[model samples]
Target: RDLNEYLFEPSKLVAKVTDIYLNFAEYDQFCSAVSNDGMSYNEQLFPQAIEVLERIRHPRERIDAFLKLGEHIKTIADQHKEDDVIYNDAPEEYIDQISSILMNDPVMLPSSRTILDRSTVIRLLLDNQIDPYTRDPLHMQ
Candidate 1:
């Protein structure tokens, strides 16, 4: 049935959603995903990823997304490193990579973190610490 097909083909839908979110930076994907009736496999993951993706455009949003994600990742990380700052350690060089993303758009930056100079984000992206292109919102979520 067509409905079954929609529910089962979550991967394809996710790809489509990601393309729209990344290229156009639109939130309609959330609405469409919600239209899937909440029974689809990717239903939850798709919208959740969008929430994470939206943060990239603004600093404050980014912080909120990461903090939420960090909490989620913390469960697994706690098993290894219980301390909060364990993952916070970014080498000075790595810090420089994300700068462009930060300075270019202040609102896109998060409010929680100290927000190392824009240079830091730039370095992270340039040095390979952060893969800006390949990165998906789902990753942080």
Candidate 2:
């Protein structure tokens, strides 16, 4: 089924998006409580979500309200990061090889089978299309 069908209704669409945003916010809070990694999956997706919302012909008030909520979530995330303590007790396998930090969201490189933090891999791929460890052509699935 095409998601566009369900998202055509502004009220339903807003509700779904808000639910997803809340879930991301909760996950970020959980991560912040455990580690001071300075990474947020919500932050990564906010711009994309905003761009999509801008293209939709939704009520201005709804968009504004969503933006306001997003800002509040970001503020809370920032505060959590500020007060978070560095976690140094992660097992070696749980650490990102590239960043040398605890991996909150880890992914394995298909070619090399090496595990690294999702954010680190994304940053690396932005600079080059090859895997850092194997220098092989990489595609993030």
Candidate 3:
């Protein structure tokens, strides 16, 4: 049957579609694609997908349920360096952004004092064998 057949079903298909869109691997791609480009990337596909996800009863349940996805999204955004460029190159007001969703968000990793990516930090610090205060920022003085 075509989509028209289900259009009048009145079933909770909309909710289910929302659930998948909200909590799925594709979400990362969606976020990155949108962040890197815009709604024009896939035309109305992104917006339409978001609409379906929002129709769910508890959308956050799906979005927040998977912390890894958020982590990936944050990391992807960070790795893209868009925020960093704005924070550094652009005016202060031009690139202000919070990597962590909340002030208490687990750093940016699955573990460690930093939270977000403790291993990445540990590896970098260890490679340089420098103390926190004497790292690159201090010019390794």
Candidate 4:
């Protein structure tokens, strides 16, 4: 029973990660449609997310597939950016506090009330649970 419970937790986590990945893809599609340009998720931080996913050890095939797809997407997006400028006209207010880049998916921290890119926050939280600005416990909902 203990072993079963332990295994079950990772499966649940995998499901959640998959959902987040799909949502990001949908959002990227929306951005592409509206901008008629190559704006997509921050390619710089994508590798970090993939590294996290690679650590998950059932569903090996599913995880591998995701990694493959993510790599392909990143490659294509990189090519597009090289051909044209992306988000060069973004306002200063739309920048992420941490990354200092144009925010693709901005999220507000409840404690510090600081706005940062979703990718930046996720990367920080993966290393530490505390909010970077306030140093308070961050509860992701």
Using lDDT as the measure, the top candidate is 2
Ranking according to lDDT, highest score first: 2, 4, 3, 1
* Candidate 3 clashes between residue pairs 3 or more apart in a chain or in different chains: 107-116, 108-115, 108-116, 109-115, 109-116, 109-117
Each prediction's whole-model lDDT (CA): 0.41, 0.67, 0.44, 0.66
Candidate 4 achieves a global lDDT of 0.66
Q: Residue 54 CA error for candidate 1 (Å)?
A: 19
Query: Residue 86: error of model 1 in Å?
Result: 31
Instruction: Name the regions of candidate 3 deviating beyond 4 angstroms.
Output: 1-18, 22-31, 40-63, 66-68, 82-141
Candidate 2 regions exceeding 4 Å error are: 1-86
Candidate 4 residue pairs that clash: none
What's the distance in Å from true for residue 138, model 3? 53
Off by over 4 Å in 4: 1-84
lDDT of 3 by residue, 35-104 (tens): 4553343333444444555555445656354334445555675666665464454433322132322222
Question: TM-score for every candidate vs. truth?
Answer: 0.17, 0.42, 0.25, 0.43
lDDT of 4 by residue, 1-141 (tens): 796766767545655766466456545564343233336455554455555556654266656666655666666666556644666577788988777767879999999999988978888888888898889998777
Deviation in angstroms for 83 in model 3?
Answer: 8.8
In model 1, what is the error at residue 37, expressed in angstroms?
18
- lDDT score for residue 131 of model 3: 31
Error of 1 at 73 (Å): 18
Tens digits of per-residue lDDT, candidate 1, 35-141, equal 32335533345446555455444345543543444344334434333332553564543342443212322222232333445444444446654435444221111
Q: TM-score ranking from best to worst? A: 4, 2, 3, 1
Candidate 1 vs candidate 3: which has greater TM-score? 3
